[model samples]
Target: MNITFFIKEFHLRHPVIKEIKSALIKRGVNLDFVVLKETILDLQSLGHLKFASNSDLVVFKTTKYFAEHLAILMEDEGLRVINGSKSIRLNRDKILNNITLRKSGIKTPKTITFHSSEIKKISQKMFPMVIKPVVGGRARDVKLVSNKSELEKNEKNDDIVIGQKYIENDGLDRKLYVVDDKVFGIFKPSVLTPSDNSNAFKEFKVEEDLKEIALKCGEITNSKIYGVDVVLGEDGPYVIETNDFPGFRGIKNAGKIIADFLYFKKNEKR
Candidate 1:
């Protein structure tokens, strides 16, 4: 079977790109790289191409807006898209996903989603608040707001916002990759402080109970390839967020596991 991999740009040097290519090759499955930069100006355009192109499966190391758009387009084409558009959209938006999880009886932080005008009301509810973009990703604009003044300052920016009471915990954030209802790997996100601007997160061994949360989250998102980030709170484990396409780092046998899944699925059709 032919699997098409989507990327922002085509490069032989990137480790993730190379890893996907090499792993697929070893299993004797046909792989092709589709670079968004070469063919389209934006995600919408790139998405159109994926719908037109032929492939048995499409996989991504991480989720992006364009990747999400592509999934929707593929759905229109009647192609079976992995991590379909709806799932990606939910996972990328902290406010929406948090609301959904809470409604579903899943544990999430107490959140208040609102327009910028609602900051005054939000400030009244709690202090030592955390503020982040409702739709932002890669933790690009995550911030901690200590009080009303800080929240008001951020309000000037007219973007959808998710405000929540910051849970002060010493526990590290965990990353869990669930493939087809099974825990493929677990990782601990590298520590970050206010002073550190670096986006890198580290991986560690899977916690005993964390796997259960990950699997439950996977079922909630309804995506085959998804990642869940959770933190240990005073009450118990609380899910911070869910990712549609989780990045694989420092996970043993990740590439092989993913490649094997593809290999087996391809042969099963024939």
Candidate 2:
């Protein structure tokens, strides 16, 4: 069977991807990769790409606009894409992801999304909130603001942002990685805290409630392989974010699990 990975060039060197690639190669599966940065998507001629046309399964790894558009086009041609374009688009927008989770009765922190121009109009009561880009990953530019001055000073007045009420938790973040029906938890230092060993990740037991929430997020977003960030708040656990095609850095044997899932999925009847 043929399998194609649509990813950024940097992802080719990721340990997890490397391991998965090695395993797939050992199994003698035909594999191809399209580096998004180097490839051009010709909208006028959709199905002409040899990689997409010959693949039995396409792993939609990158969330870039071009990759998403191509994935949508591939789906239009009846090719199966993991985590689908809709799921990637939904997870890309922090505001939309929060709204969708809340509408689905999922417990999430109180969030307010507004344009940067309206920053001064925000209420002071919302101080001590976490301000982050509406569409971002890896917690880049995420900040904790205690007042309007800090909020205005920390965030640029040119893009959309979301101010989420900070949920007090022990300085550890519960990162739950979901692979199909299975879920694995990893404990790591919170992004707000300064940790010399930020890369340190340890395995943790996945509680039933957390597992349920993780699975529900998958169902809500229509994602099979994803990650859910949760923090233990005063009222149990609250989901912080859901990431599509997350890097499963902490899970043991993650490459094998993911490869097995892909092989089974590729061979299964649609």
Candidate 3:
């Protein structure tokens, strides 16, 4: 089968990307990859790629816009998409994901969604809260605000934001990657200090319960692959968020897992 790997032009040199490309080539799959850069002309390139599409599967590693656009074209051509438009769109937004998790009876952090105008109202409900953009991943636009003054001082973006009480922890964060209703891998993020927040990921491992939650989360999201971040809180293990098509920045063995899924017998279905 012909495969079109859509990776960000800036991230083409990442080790995981190289490894997957190489493994797919060895599998005798006709792999064609295009480095899609972030630019004003991105839409044009996306259109060209869609129009020129000939692959049986399209593996995207970038924004939802590209995935959604390509998914539409691919659907017209009857091609299968790994992280399809529906899955990507549903899991990317924190608000939508929370709704799904709640409906699925899965345990996630207690969250309060509010308009920018309701920021003060949110402050009254929770303290030592974590505020984040609804349509975000990998801790982007996530802030830990301790009080109302801080929340009000921060400039709000266009995206809807959610505020949730921060659960005090033993200071370890777990990232669990789930694929096809199974726990693919779990890593403990590496951190230099408890307060250090420059880099988003601290590279941690597969605690059995975290693995289970990861699997359940994958099933809930209905995505072939996604990352579930969880924290050990006062109540229990609470899911921090679900990320669709998340990056494997500092995780060990993640590249191999992704490669195996892409080129191995298990991924033969789609």
Candidate 4:
């Protein structure tokens, strides 16, 4: 079986990547890498991807923009992409992710999305609100709106942003990493604060309720790999967001688990 990792950069320097590569090699699976930077600007490269590779699976660790586009192109050529094309598209947009999850009976924060043009019509909902780019990830362009001046200053005509009711949890965020059926949590503290951009990660053991929420979320997104962002509110755990790609730092054995799953599926297909 051949597995291709299409990423912005190789995780070769990372121990996790090494472990995954070693595991796949042991299973006689061929592992390959393609730099997304080399393809995003060259439509010709993407157009010829299917004709170029006879790989069994494509694993996307690239930009959501490229991932969504390549997913369709790859699938049209009768190739399977992990996490699926539709799921990738949904996960890329926070508005869509929130709507899909809520519609699936999964709980998420109250959100309102608007093009930068519609900011004038947006009446203030509450302070301590969150402004998130609909097409943003890794907390890029995410801001906390504490007052009118900050909200007014946040307007950007080019991008759409989601105004969400901020859920609080002692200045920390719970990120649950899901690989297929398994779920693990990482407690990232002050990562959202503008002062500390670094992720101070600590292992968070998944409780039964958190696991349930994560599974329900995965089912809705059709996600084989996922990260569900949940906050502990006064009532209980509230899932505010989800991501297709999250740094799986605390999940030991993650590489082996993913490797085994791929090999098992490849064998089943054969």
Candidate 5:
């Protein structure tokens, strides 16, 4: 099998990438490493390099702006794209993710999206909410505002953020990873909580219920390979967000699972 792997320099250091690359090669798969952003050239230019045409599939991992559109272009050219461009575009917007998930009967946190101009629409019920940029990853710029003062303090002029009712958990959360028919997850501490309960991750098992929710998330996002972050609330697990390219840092055998699926299982007839 031949696959075109899209990765940028910013993500070049992730250990999982190295592991996946090595594992895929061992399985008799050929990989063409391409920097999606660097491949652009004018048709009028003397030297115009073409995207690899012999690739069986394009396995993209970067969240770089405009990269998804490029992937879409390749898909339009008859190349199979893993975790399709539509899924990546949906993952880029948290507001869209929340709305679509809810409409699909998948439970997510009560959320609202607003910009600085629409700040007056924020209600008292939304107080003590968690706020984050509509497009971001790794929890960067995420904040929990328990009061009006905090909300105002964190608010920036013309800023747009997705505010969701903070689901209270005892620092227990799950990151569910999906690769084709393989769905598994990890229980870990919430990054938003005040406590460092990372040590308790080992105690959490991959429950059947969690797998069901994770698979539902994949269906909702139309992504065969993705991640769903679930916050275990008093009622049950409420999906926090879904990732187009989830970093499976400590999850057991994640690299092998993803690599093997792309190399072989995805094309297998059920």
Candidate 6:
């Protein structure tokens, strides 16, 4: 079987990808990589894109806009893409993700989204909120504001922002990485706190409830491979975010699990 990975150059150096590549090679699966940043797409005609038509599956690993458009084109042409183009686009927006999760009867933090210009009108009662960009990752531009003054002082250049009620937690992040039917949990330091690499990324057994939430996320997004960021608040578990093709940083044997899932999926119909 032939498989193509649509990813950025930096992904080639990722440990999970490296292991997956090695395992798949040993399995004699033909592999191809297309660096999203460097690959050019001819929009004039779908017939010009021979690679899309030739591959059995495309593992979309990047979130670039151009890559998304290309994935859509491939899907339209009857090619299969993991975490499909619609899923990629939905997971990229924090507002939509939150709403979708809530509407689907999943628990999430109470969030209010608004334009940066309307920041001044925000009530002081909404203090002690976690604010972040509508489209962001890796905790970049994420802020914890305790008061209106702090909120006003936050970086305001973003076109949109989401303010979520801060859930009281033990300061450790509970990250659930999902690969097909399996869900792996890890305890890591909160990005808001100082990094402690020594104590980070220790894998642990996931509770059934958390597992259900993780799998439900996959169903909601129509994604086979994804990650859910949940915080164990004083009340209960609340999903903070979901990511498509997340870097499976802490899961044990993640590469083997993911590769096996892909191989099984490739041959499931046959």
Task: Please give the CA lDDT of all the candidate structures.
Answer: 0.67, 0.86, 0.68, 0.76, 0.77, 0.83
Candidate 1: regions farther than 4 A off: 10-14, 38-53, 60-62, 184-203, 268-270
lDDT of 2 by residue, 1-270 (tens): 899998888989998899889888888899998777845657666643556787889997878757667777789989989978888887888888999999999999889988767888887877789888888998998888888877767776778788898898877889999999999999888888656555448898898989999999999988999999998988899998899888997789999899999988999898
- How far off is model 4, as Cα RMSD? 3.0
Ranking by lDDT: 2, 6, 5, 4, 3, 1
Instruction: Sort the candidates on TM-score, descending order.
Output: 2, 6, 5, 4, 3, 1
Q: Superpose all Cα atoms of candidate 2 onto the true structure and report the RMSD in Å to 1 decimal.
A: 1.9
Number of backbone clashes in candidate 2 = 0
Candidate 2 wrongly placed segments (more than 4 Å): 38-40, 47-50, 195-200
Off by over 4 Å in 6: 38-41, 45-49, 194-199
Instruction: Decide which is better by TM-score, 1 or 3.
Output: 3
* Candidate 2, position 269, lDDT: 92
Q: After best superposition, candidate 1 residue 96: deviation in angstroms?
A: 2.5
Q: What is candidate 6's lDDT per residue for 1-270, written digit by digit as tens? A: 888888889989999999999888888899999777754656776442467678778888877647667778878877877868877886888888899989998899888987767877877667688988888877887888887767767746757789988888877788899988999998888876546556567898999999999999899988899889998887899999898888889787889889988877776653
Clashes per candidate (backbone, < 3 Å): 3, 0, 9, 0, 0, 0
- In model 2, how large is the Cα lDDT of residue 113? 88
Write the number of the candidate with greater lDDT, choosing between 3 and 5: 5
What is model 1's C-alpha RMSD? 4.0
Which candidate tops TM-score?
Answer: 2
lDDT of each residue in 1-270, candidate 4, tens digit only: 688877666455666667777899998898887666653446766543753268788777654446777777887887767767777888887888889988988877788887766666766665667887888777877788875567777775677678887776666688899888888988776445533425447776899999999998988888888899887888888888888856687788877877787767655552
Model 4 whole-model lDDT (C-alpha atoms) = 0.76
Better of 2 and 6 by TM-score: 2
What residue pairs clash in candidate 4, if any at all?
A: none
